[model samples]
Target: MAQHALVTGSSHGLGAHLAARLAADGWKVTGLGRRPASETPGTPGVDHLQADLSRPETLERITDRLGEAPDLIVHNAVSYPPRPAHELSLAELEDVFRVNALVPYRLTLDLLAATPDTRFTSIVVINSESMFHADRDSGAYAASKAALRVLTGSLADACRSRNTAVATLLLGPLADPDKVAQLQRVAARRGVDEAEITRVFLRKSNPDLVIEELIDFDACYRSVQYLAGLGRAANGMLCRLDGGSAGSLI
Candidate 1:
């Protein structure tokens, strides 16, 4: 049977790539996000479900809309301008956690409870390199990922007793991103040309197909997991390249 997979933050970036990759593997991929259709990534055959994971009220609807428990689930949402350590207001900190960490944590509980009878489901999470090394001025991002890493262990423990499978995809930096235009804008503001910015972006994208340090995995996915197939890259419909070490990956 084709495995059913759910990927959060599927509106773009890592979630988008995982959705496309899984679909290519013959799994039924579902993309979940709060963004409108225009903002969503174009992953053909992926069922897109948009619901704000932060709100408690929408969960029931999320469950209703998801239709069935997934065999695989990838938590890949991210936050930008990652939380600062000292000045992070309660809202500022919690806002990132709500999407990047907390929702994924809670959703795992719901997913497991909803599918109690299953012997195992392949679970994958997208974690940060920052969890290993602190990024400059991004303590909140590091903390959020670190907390999730702990939670991943906890959930793996919880599921180990239940015979469910879990894997974590730790990323050093994504080679590809959907924010080229935004990056270019920032470069312009800094009085730098866009070509120079492009060169800088390439250098920062991950050179390796996979890196061990950045992701936290209790188990592993034994395959080369590119976000999209060649057509997406060749035609330039979407830019899902990995980034150098300093990628805007959070």
Candidate 2:
């Protein structure tokens, strides 16, 4: 039988791409997001579960929808609103934590409890480089991600007796159209080519890095796949798919 995978925040970005890629790789994929099922990524065998992670109540239906435990669970849902530390409101902080940390914790526990008979081989949490180095106006987002990273460690400890492996992926800025446009603007402002600007930024951030500057969606998918393939022997591990960004900082 093919392995089953559950991916949260599969409506767009890395989650959507990862879900589609897993489906194409012959894994039975279930995507959870707020968008309508039809709007999810194009994968013929994938099932889309519509839920808003910001609301804890919506997550109650996850176990009912799966009917069984999945082999791999990827927590990729996140709320990223750029605001300075002083400008962050209570509501905004709560919202970010709800989606980034609380929902993933609840869902992981729910699935683990619901699937007593089945073994969850791996749980992958999608994290950001900001968890280590917070950028300007990203205090709230960084704090939430840092919390998620800590949660990943705690979850890994809890799963040790059950032989379930947990992996946290720290990723850098992905190569997308919006990011490309932003890079272009920076390039124009610095009077340098986009490639040169990217190189300079990466070098300035971390001089020890030899990997590529930008991480793409496919890189994220492949990294998750590698984690899932590690079986139960891997245990708790922090895997960086950031193209050496984290290596430079720490």
Candidate 3:
């Protein structure tokens, strides 16, 4: 049988791309997300599980849906809205943290418990540069991602003896038009020009970012696959996929 891989947040965007790539590479891929596969288009060979990570009832029974524990679990699901720390409400913070950090932590435990001791697996946690660098507007999202980094480290420590390797990827800026548009909306709200907001965002998030060519899905997928194949050797590793820009920074 092909190596089984379970990817969270695979309904769309980066998660979906990664799922497709994995399936194409001969891995049996299962996608877990809130959206049903019928309503949301997915890769041809990928299986999807519809579950809202925020709901405890659904999360509690998620393991029941997977017939076999996955050899690779990709925690690609994320909840990030551009909000300042002072503006983020407690409810909103909890909701973001639940999806971003808590879900991965819970799923790791659940999957490990279901797995037999004879098998070794890998868990890849997708993160952003914000995990290490703080931003003024996106502070709340950064904090949650930072929390995820810590949790992944703890998991690496706890699961090493069980032959479960865990790693976190701190990615630099990607070519996301949606994120640019989100910043544009913020600029509108602040009565500032879009260019000014974009400039400031680049300055803070990735000062050396090559504006013409940001990280693409292909590069990101390559990183994920590389880390996934490393297995036990990569436990507790924090790999940076920032193209020598932010990764090299002090």
Worst 10 residues of 2 by lDDT: 205-214
Looking at model 3, how many pairs of residues clash?
0
Error of 2 at 218 (Å): 1.4
- For all candidates in order, the CA lDDT equals 0.64, 0.82, 0.83
Per-model root-mean-square deviation over C-alphas: 8.6, 2.5, 4.3
lDDT winner: 3
TM-score of each: 0.70, 0.88, 0.85
Error of 3 at 93 (Å): 0.8
What is the alpha-carbon lDDT of model 1 when measured against the actual structure?
0.64
Candidate 3 lDDT, tens digit per residue, 228-248? 889788899978877555545
Most accurate candidate by TM-score: 2
- How would you encode candidate 2's per-residue C-alpha lDDT over 56-109 as one tens digit per residue? 678777789788689899999988775776688888788899899988987898
Write the residue-wise lDDT of candidate 1 on 8-101 in tens digits: 8788665676677778779898899879767876678789888776665766677668878887777877775443567778877777777777
